[model samples]
Target: MILLGYGFIQKIGSRDFFFKVIIYFALFSAVNHVYLVVNWAIDNPININRLRLYAGKGDVIELFGFIFIFCRKKLQINFRRKSYVKIAFVLLTISFLLYFSRTQAVAAIVIISSIYGYTKLNKKAIIVISSFVVLAGGFFWYLNKMEIPRSAEGLEGFLYKIKNAPKEMFSTDINVNNRAELWDKWRSYEAKLAIEQVLNDRSSTLVFGKGIGALVDLKDDFMLNGKLERKIPTIHNGYAFVFFKSGILGLSLYFFVVIILYLKAYSLKSANAISIATNNLLSGFGLYLMFTTLVVAGLYNTNSTVPLILGFILGVEHLNNLSVNEDSDNRN
Candidate 1:
């Protein structure tokens, strides 16, 4: 971690937003580590429920850091001095309310906070900040409203069989429970094995995957005594989903697309605090959702696509800002 920190610091002199993200992740991870050990010591065994809670908690922390950046930029609210910064207290209250849950509550609070920050700032800055809050709220609302796909539902049912089976299991898309229900305890480990198996055995699968209807073939009930039967090809992991449907080539394509989007977000660091915070927020939110939803929900569900869409938004913003800066330099 220290070595990673050094590498990140090395980028402090230039466009090194990627490295900065690494720093934030590392720092938060360190803090997480301390609490991890503490919680385990207190309870004798770490709580799975707490681990689940950790995802949203970590997101709240990142959001707070972004608020700090916005405060510093638009509000000029500094809290590190001798006298307490008045606006810092107000923003802190609003942030606490915003981050209490991972919902649309943040939008209203963020807008209010931005307006407070924008009071002495320019119209453009205010518009940008307000726009971000609206976009973020709209995106998350979409994710929340989206129904779990039938494929994902099938994967959930598939996972149920794996949990109950005695060395022999067959199912399809049966893993998703009613919100953290079922044998989620051992589920992720099984998904990890599935991903490993697919990665290790890519050569024999014709490098194209089991094909589009591969999962469909596995959903039959193999009953014996007029009661019930089984299924097959029920891998619940997302990358595994791509591998099963399209092979290593397909998984590679999907993986590359996500990485490229993240790289685009990182590219904006040289612009300003808003750019950096926006990029890091997207990265943090993506990774946070990736780890949480991939283990529990399927990848196709895509907990949020706001980040990729936002990355494109930032790319446009960057080009326009660059053109403006160039014209200003020419004028000077």
Candidate 2:
């Protein structure tokens, strides 16, 4: 997908066009999400779990669209685009909050806050802040409308997930008697097993990994049914997935690529609003990818749009560099 995005951008020869494409797709996704929510609400008015079914992996990319539009509005003085920004912000925010994904919600708040910090505070800033307050109040009101009986329902469920995040990522203790705790710690358990297998294998395996198609053995077969299958093909941790398949070398190479792209995007200096917004979007996405890898498989997750977006950003940067070089030569 990365290569495809890069090639496509090269063919199009306009970063602005690509940005618009992303935004348009995001809007389409938001509308579909709203439809899903409304349709589900009409059918299952009392079921919170049914509402959660509408959340999809595409929500993250849609979020990137929101960030792109928001930053563009903040950096540029375009009164005509204000309405579009407000509409996109409201729709995307509703879709995002409906997803109930803690990682994504955290990423959005942190990235948006960071962007807000660097930009000047004005009427636009006040509008954004006020919008957030209104949306947050609405979110809580929606939660109140739901009949949440368990810890894993509505706002309570979201808080429970946040509370268990550390244990999910690092805890070694697994309580078989408590199904909730077991499910919460599943990622950590699988990751630990993968790491143990790598270390126990031949030293050579540590360098090149078990080499794709490798499986990690869960000694107890806790996740298995009556079939006695203890080995699994994949784990949730992106780092472990890479290390398990290709060893430390592959993992290092992956980080190297991510770091290079992030730095390139961050280093891009532009007075143009679109270029500046693109630079911020790319760099913010790099940070989001780095954080999400610990739990959501990050770039390795097939559901994620990270690779495609990263590729597009890389292509834009490549073109930007070429334009810079051409100008330098012409000046000389």
Candidate 3:
């Protein structure tokens, strides 16, 4: 899909057109998400999981739209058109907030801050950082005052998830006897098991991995159906997932791709608004991918749009280079 998207962008040959298309698609998606959220609120206000079910994987594309518009530099736009873009941006943001995904929310903050710093917008950067601090403080206060539970529903459930996020990722006090405890720290637990399995193997699996379809033993079966399946084929931690299946070589290769993309994006000299936006988008996404790997499988997740976005940016860079070469030849 990534390569296909790359080839498609190159064939299009116009970055402006591609950008416009993405913007339109993003706007339409945002509207749909808002509608879903509204309807869900009216019909199943207590069931936040249902909202997630209805809006599966749409948040990823919506984040792309938000980042593009947020990082955009001065592109001449009429007042009415600019108003519409603003509305779309707001809709995207609202829908994203409703999703209650900590990883995506954190990625958005990091990406935006990185872009602001890269662009030398010190004032905006300071303001954004300050705002984040204030909001975080308020959130913590609410969590403490309300004492929200893990099984909570709706907005309270979202807050509880955020409150537990740090412990979820790193806590070592899980009770093996407690199924709920195991499920709560599921990502960390699975990663620990994967590491143990890799170390237990004394073969070349250390370097080359256990190969595809390798399952990590969870010691006990935790399937919802009460089946005797004690092994799970996938882990939420993407780095661990790759290491378990492909070994160290595969993990290194994944990092290599991210590093290369970051370098390529950083090397770009932004000569115009489009160049600037693309550079920031690519650079920020590379960083976002690195952060998300620890929590959400990052590039390995089939539902993610990270690879597609990466390929699209690379395609844009390729077209820009081609155009530059043509102009230089004409000058000669």
Instruction: Assess each prediction's global lDDT (C-alpha) against the native.
Output: 0.43, 0.71, 0.73
For candidate 3, write residues 1-332 as lDDT tens digits.
Answer: 67977898989886765556666677788788778778877876566756787765346777766766765552222234677777777887787777767887788877776655542335775777688789988977777787777788888777777777766777767788987777778778888889779978977998988989888888986674366778878788889889999889999999997776555445656454455555565667677888888888888877677777767767886776777667768989
Off-target runs (Cα >4 Å) in candidate 1 are 1-182, 189-206, 216-236, 264-269, 289-293, 296-299, 302-332
Relative to the true structure, candidate 3 reaches a TM of 0.83
Evaluate model 2: give its lDDT: 0.71
1-332 per-residue lDDT for model 2 (tens digits): 99998998999997676667777788888888878878877876444455665545347668777666666554342435667768877887777677767777767774666454422245775777688779867865666566644456656666555556778899987875787777779899888889889999999989999988888887765645347667878788988888988899999997886565455444645534445555555656666777788888888887778788888877876676677677778989
Model 1 C-alpha lDDT per residue in residues 210-302, reported as the tens digit of each score: 666654222234332364534334544566567666877887887775555444444553555545444444443344334433433323534
TM-score of 2: 0.79
Candidate 3: stretches off by over 4 Å: 47-50, 54-58, 74-80, 117-146, 224-229, 269-273, 326-332
Highest lDDT among the candidates is held by which one?
3
TM-score of each: 0.37, 0.79, 0.83
- Pairs in steric clash, model 3: 209-247
Determine which window of 10 residues in candidate 3 has minimal summed lDDT.
71-80
Model 2: C-alpha RMSD to truth?
Answer: 6.2
Rank by lDDT, highest first.
3, 2, 1
